[model samples]
Target: MPFSVYALGLAVFAQGTSEFMLSGLLSGIAADLHVSVPAAALLTSAFAVGMVIGAPLMALLGRNWPRRRALLFFLCVFAAVHVVGALTSSYGVLLVTRVVGALANAGFWAVALVTAVALAGPEARARATSVVVGGVTVACVAGVPAGAWLGGQWGWRAAFWAVALVSLPAIAVIAATIPAGRSGAALPSARAELRTLAGPRLLLTLLTSALVQGATFCAFSYFEPIARHITGLGSAWVPALLALFGTGSFIGVTVCGRIIDRRPVAVTAAGLVALTAGWVLFASAAGSAVAVVALVLVQGMLAFGTGTALISHVFRLADGAPTLAGSFATAAFNVGGALGPWLGGLAIGAGSGFRSPLWVSAALMVVALGTAGAAWTRRSAPALRSDVHAYEQGSSDG
Candidate 1:
């Protein structure tokens, strides 16, 4: 991997930390600002909407700019947004700042993936992406927990201020280290990228991406309440358990490449199965602390592992439309992110047990799995039947 890749990873780490830290501080933020928890949750969804809106727009507008300059400029914008988020006092103003920050966050990831792929060349492209995305894994493990803890101890605003502090060094590092390469035509244009959606397999890939996220996060969005109600854990235990779940995600992402490279479809199927099993267990047997913890860990692992495979599969199917396909996967993720929390909240409101969300999650996973299996079978049926018929005829002749 290029040294520049590591620099990019640092910037990614900072961005990921800022994006995810809000989850930890949600309750604190609501109490501090005198808003409902659900309303505060809108900030999280706002970020997703921002990413969905900004990723393509930024990719297209910055299509002609130097990759390094584009990245640095966005990082600067991201940092400035953090400052806005940190300094704001009014609830409405803070919400707008969060949206602005998320917009910058989305563009950064879209651009970073293209730059990382270009920098790594054909042989190590997957490996390079893993390194860049590893930052997100780390954010889950460390950033969210720390931010939550800090918010509980001091104030929610402290967390955003801390993120701004981290961004200052990230900005300097990005300016100093990343190369100013003129990758004008290194990847496809946004229009060319969008055209990849024209392929039949693209829909399958998008469905898979959306389902995997929807399944996991539907259960995941209600994690704090689930932990308290189902596992008999106190409110204090939520962050620690979430941190543990993040640990599982880290391990999953780290090893996912090997699993997918060996057998993409099979591994994806297995992951869906594992995720379904995890939810089933959570619904039925999560009363025990050990069982609950184990289920959460497995859920995180399978969900993220499956997502990595699904996104990579989309990239492969896109063939000529690398960046656009990547953006499509990003968009699917945002869509799933939006759906998961909303639906999960509805389940809770319906007076079902905490496990009700798990049931909903399992159902979504079943649909996703069915979609993936159908698509794969359709894609492979002709070749498989042709090979089998020829082999049978040859055996009869012998």
Candidate 2:
């Protein structure tokens, strides 16, 4: 809850904008670069790929570096790339910038998550994570839209310039706030951290993280079409709906932070189930304006709330591998982010209607929920049996 922790959120906000802002500029970028729209869209994919690969790699590579130094390093790298991207006329150069920017962003999150926990303490890890994730939701609500508007007004390159400019202040804030120590969280050796990957508990937690994000993006990716086809909303309403979803998500992340550490499994499982039901309701109540609006808001809340909880679970589950934890969690998310939209695209392309992605989202959430439930049951079973045996023995004596 320190001001410094919030400063870390500022860093995340800057990097996150770079990740989500491209969608609004894709067409303009395609036209500017004389590439197909589909080709232009590959920049997004390139960013994701960098994020996935960069998280663990950068985290490990900088495992020994000072936390403050590591954070600033990533931020500076991210900002520099955006500047390069903004100046580059060649599509190929811009493509490389996206990957480099994402790599830097991933490193920042890996270090930031650990730093947030160190700054806030382990007891408030979830709360610290909420602060971190709250940045992304704010990016969704504000950054993406602003980037789109900027792109429309000036050009796609201007959005890139804006991102680079926005990131500069984050560098100053993060450097001023974060500890100068060589690393806040002391990491185990690389061998031991890698061994942690073999743990079932961590693997399950990672899976939950992926599914949570996958489910979220699956439905979110097609929100524009869903609004148009299902609720028959005009183009004007789409941004409002997305913003509403972001607002709900911001609220949910805050709420989840308060209780996730206390009731991680119960809250996450319940949330995923609720999200699944919300998707079903969305699919079924397509014609109802109120239902569509309500479901979108609630779905956003459940998705982000559960996501924060799951990542918190990952940090806990991978506690022994502190150096690797955040990176793995980050990787799980990018993996999910990439997969979800692909699935949604497939669903829509197959002519299953706009709601097909809703079903896909529901199914993925159900799986995530089931994974958490089953793991809890499995862990609880032995304790339950031991209690029963003791109770039966006492009864016989009585």
Using TM-score as the measure, the top candidate is 2
RMSD (CA, Å), each prediction? 3.2, 2.1
Q: After aligning candidate 2 to the native by TM-score, how far in Å is the CA of 271 from where it should be?
A: 1.1
Q: Candidate 1, which ten residues in sequence have the lowest lDDT sum? A: 122-131
**Which regions in candidate 1 have their CA more than 4 angstroms from the true location?**
27-38, 184-189, 381-398
lDDT of 2 by residue, 1-398 (tens): 98888888877877778898888999999999999999998999999999999999999988888889989898899999998999889999999999988999999999889889878988899999999989998888898899999999999988888888887777888878877886534668998988887677678778888988998899898999889978899989999998899888898999999999898778877887788888887888877889989888888888889899988888887778877788998999999999999999898899898888888988888898777777677668889999999999999999
Residue-wise C-alpha lDDT for candidate 1, range 2-115, written one tens digit per residue: 777777777777777777787768888888788999898888778888887887777666767776788878888888877887777678988898788777777777778767
Candidate 1, after superposition: displacement of residue 336 in Å? 1.1
Return the TM-score for candidate 2, rounded to 2 decimals.
Answer: 0.95
